[model samples]
Each structure stands twice: as structure tokens, then as C-alpha cells.
Target: MPYFAVLYDYAPGSDPLREHHRAAHRAYLNETDHGTVAVVATGPWSDGEPGALLVVSAPGPGELHAMLDRDPFRLHGAVAQRRIRSWTPVTGPWA
Candidate 1:
């Protein structure tokens, strides 16, 4: 499995909706384990940015894409912008 870093910016005023679907999102992350689809890290960004970052292990690009497609926030328009990138670590824990 390859590592990937995903960042998604939430829509303005979508906090309520995100709160409503928070449980579901967390649940999906917990249950969507396919050995390779491991969510290694996740958290929100500070500085008035309504967004989150997730570092995960995925088998391929399409697998990651499908995972995001199934995310409640993305499906519900809470995610206004995103940047997903493949990571190759040489000195970090993953390395």
C-alpha cells in the first residue's frame, strides 16, 4: 500500500451539517478497513479554516478516490475544496 495525504476544506457555515454527520464519518473510517485502507492520522486545521487532514494507506489512486467519494461531507457538499496527494516519505515514521 502507498501513503496518501488528503486535505478538504469545509464550506462556509457548514459546521452544523458536519456536526450532524460527524458520527457517520467516523464510523466509516473505522469500518472501511481493507488492510490497506488504514487511516493513520486525521484532524481539523486551526486558524479559522473549516477543514480536515487525513493521512492514509491506500493500494492505489482510484482506491483513495473511491474512499473520498463515499465520505459524507463530500457527498453532502460540506467539502468545498480538496487537495489529495500521494506521499513518499524518506525520513518520517512511515519511512
Candidate 2:
């Protein structure tokens, strides 16, 4: 398995929609069967930005993207963009 650093950029002025679907979103994250994918860490940006970062493990980018597509936030149009990149944690707890 490989790891990926996923960044979710929220759509402009979609706060209300995000709030409306927040519980569902969290539930999805907590309860979904991601198959080979494993969510390592996930949370919203605390720097006054409307976005989130999720570090996960999957077989590849395609599978990761497919899994993310099921996210409540993404399905409900709360996310404007998603950036996925390969990540290698050579040190720290993740290493």
C-alpha cells in the first residue's frame, strides 16, 4: 500500500452547505468501508481557511480518488477542488 496526502479545497460560500452536511460527512469518514484504503489523519484547516487535509493509504491514486468521491462533502458540492499527491513519511510517528 502507498500513502497519499489529500487536500480538499471548499467551494466559495459553501459554508452553509458544509454545515448542513457536516454530520453526514463525519459519519461517512468514520464508518465507510474504504476497502484497501485507510484514513490516517483527517481534519479541516485551522488557519481560517475553508478546506481540509486527509492523509490516507490506498493502492493507488485511482482508488483513492474513487473512495474520496463518496465523501458527503464532495457529493454535495462542498468541495471545489481536490489535490492528491504521493507522500513518504521518512520520520516522525507516521514513519
> Which prediction has the highest TM-score against the true structure?
2
lDDT of each structure? 0.85, 0.92
Q: Candidate 2: give the clashing pairs.
A: none
TM-scores, each model vs. reference: 0.87, 0.95
| Sequence-dependent TM-score of model 2 | 0.95
How would you encode candidate 2's per-residue C-alpha lDDT over 11-56 as one tens digit per residue?
9999999999999998888864888888889999999898999999
Give the Å error, residue 60, model 1.
1.4
User: What value of lDDT does candidate 1 attain over all alpha carbons?
Assistant: 0.85
Summarize candidate 1's per-residue lDDT along 1-95 as a digit string, tens digits. 78999999899999998999998887877775644577888888877678999998898878788877888888888889888899987897899
Task: Show model 1 residue runs off by greater than 4 Å.
Answer: 32-35
The parts of candidate 2 lying over 4 Å away from their true place are none
